[model samples]
Target: MSARSLASPQSAGEQKKKLADSLIKKFNKKFNGPLNNPHLSSIIVAEVGKLLQKAKISPGDLEQVEAKISREAVSESSAVLRNEDVRLRKIKAEMSSKGGLPAALLSKEDRKILPKELKKTIASPKKKPAARVSVNMLENTVRARNAQLDKQKAKHTSVFSSLGMVGPATPDSDAGNILVGAKSLPLDQAVDPWSVLIMHDVKKYEDERKQREEQKRLQREQWKRELDDQVKINERKKKEAAMEEVKYAEEEQDQLRVADIQEKKKKEAKMMINTKLKEERAKTVAELQEQKRRQLEEQKEEEKSEVRRMEAEIARAERRQQRKREEEAERAKRLQEENKEQRKMREEERKKKHRMDLEYAASQARMLDDLERRRLEALGKIKEKMKTIEVMGDTLGHSILEKEEEDERRAEMWRQAYEKKQLKVCFFRVCWCRGACNVCVEAVRDRGGEMEKVN
Candidate 1:
């Protein structure tokens, strides 16, 4: 029996070797684990082995049970380990990628319980909120926005303030917090965010705004300049038109004045010509009247001269007729005286002849005377007586008687002769005187009658 029992201990050693091999295979198959740190794998395998030993089963049973529990534990541990390994690698990767802990890693408990060193390793640093604006910069922006809003609001204060409600406050107070409390307000009463932003960024926004405003102002100024220039041009044109009208009026007036002057000159010329013609006509009439007067005066003078010549001729004719009449009367007287002288001489001759004859006869008769003687006695006685007587008577008677007779006879003869001669002479003288005187008287009468007729 001693020999046999010693042989049985060898057989038990072989069975333990088999059980260990089966457990390793089950563990490997159940858990598909990754290759990890060798030290952790070794510690886990040793702990599994000690639990198996504590159960004190047979080597075969222990192998089976150990394999089952090891398989289960290894399967669950593989998932947990893989999860834990992946978490640790992510933590390390996060720490390496950002050079610090992820913000999500901090927990409420970790925040409360972490030591300073771990907190330093796990906590992420925070960036400060944007720095609060400077008081002066905020004041300046607010002032600028207020001033711009005021300018925009000038037309209607209520409407402009409503529209500009989002704008910054004035520089005097509360410039930065002006829009901070506006969110809880009603929609109508709220400040606009866009408007606030615009107000905050006023310097940049207003620069572009000011440029546009300047452009608009420049455009308005240019338009005003153009309008003013047009107005000036219109005024100038109106002035020129007015001046032209005045000039035309003045020219018309000048023309009228010239025409009037010309008409006046023409009238004056006509009047002068008419006056001259009238004066000439009057002068001609005066000359004609003066010529007629001179002609009349000359005719009168001629008539007067003719009358004086005729009167002188008539006086001379009268004187010549008177002288002829005186001469004819003297001739007639001389003829009568010559005829009377001749007659007286003839008468004396005849008487002397008769006496001579008587004386002769008486002488022859003386013888006869004796017879007468007887008678003579008587006679003688007578004779003696006679003688004596005769002587005485003779002486006385004879002388007386003879003387008486002779005287008578002689006286008669003388008377007869004288008477005859006187008668003849007287008759002749009368006849001549009658004829001549009649002719002369008739001529004188006719001449006187003619003179009376002429007168």
Candidate 2:
């Protein structure tokens, strides 16, 4: 068994087996097995080489070992050839001691050394020689038989004898001479052996028939005498039988008349019984027909009632469907109205919010304008008051009293402007340094814009 077959258990039976094995098997049958996969073979060879390295074996050593084996094989083959030559010489020497050279090649001097056994075998007659003698003897026996047959039936021989028991032989012919003769049949002609056997049997039958006919002719004459006596005895028996037949005919005639009368009575009784049975059968059929008619009428009534019930149910269902349709329409209309009202309210709320935003924006713009107006008006009034004080001081060149009055007037104006407009510029200018902080920068920018506006 192969490795695959040995590994399989008997009970497991047939299996396509491992996935890889099945794939490889199909691949090999389709491709050319391992030979077609050169890369795979190369990888396997490489792995094998690595494995052999563990045993300290290399490809070079493998080549040298193979070469040494080949050399030894050549030497052994040469020795074998030398031994074979010696063996052939010994065989020839034995043959020379036992017998001379074969007769085909023997010389006059070598012929005397021939073994006695071989000489006897060469001289004796074989199967072919003996068979030739037997054939000749058979031909002589056939000739003698043909002569006897001709003497018995010489006048009977004709052209048609070939198809008859004698087989076309004349008085001067030998047995089988027609079958073997060159002129008798075409060369290589096929003949059925059965035809020859049948002809021989027919000849034997003709002779047997002749003897049986002679014997039967004597028996026929003897049988005719016995038959004449038997006829007289049969005539006496016929006369007695004719008397008995007359008496039997009369008794049969009486019995036939009685049987005919009884048959007529039995026929009448059968006719009466058939009439009664027919009447019962007719009555039963009529009752069955009436019952079937009643069942059909009842079925028809039930069908009519069911049809009416179904029509009423359909009407009610239509009414319910119409009501449901109306209800759905009403609900849809109401929902449409609700959705419209909600949209209207949302639009009004959006308009109100827009108005509020516009109002707030206008109020902010008005407040900014008012603040700008107050600052400009206050700055202009302060400038006017300061110019009046400078002019009054120029007119009263040496008047201290007048200078004191101007200072009091300037303080009064500052107080009044601060109270009326909440102006803090004068106080800021008195306390602030130039660009000292956020307050000073914002005050300077505001004051510069106010002064420009006033100017």
Q: Rate the local accuracy (lDDT) of all candidates.
A: 0.43, 0.44
Q: Which ten residues in a row have the lowest lDDT in candidate 1?
A: 423-432
Clashes of each: 10, 2
lDDT of 2 by residue, 1-455 (tens): 12344245554324323422453444333222212445433433443344333424433343333223223322333343344344434434544565422232333222222333323322331222110112233455556655665565656643323323335445554433544433333212534334465566557655855875675465444433333443444445444434434543454455456546755865875687578658856976896699679868966885686587876677576775687589669967976896687688667856865886687557645744663464345335434533654464344333333434644564465456556875444333332122222343444455665311210
- Where does model 2 exceed 4 Å of error? 1-312, 385-455
Q: How far out, in Å, is residue 106 in model 1?
A: 74
Question: Candidate 1 overall Cα lDDT vs. reference?
Answer: 0.43
What are the RMSD figures for all models against the true structure?
99.9, 77.3
Summing lDDT over every window of 10 consecutive residues in candidate 2, give the lowest-scoring window.
Answer: 125-134
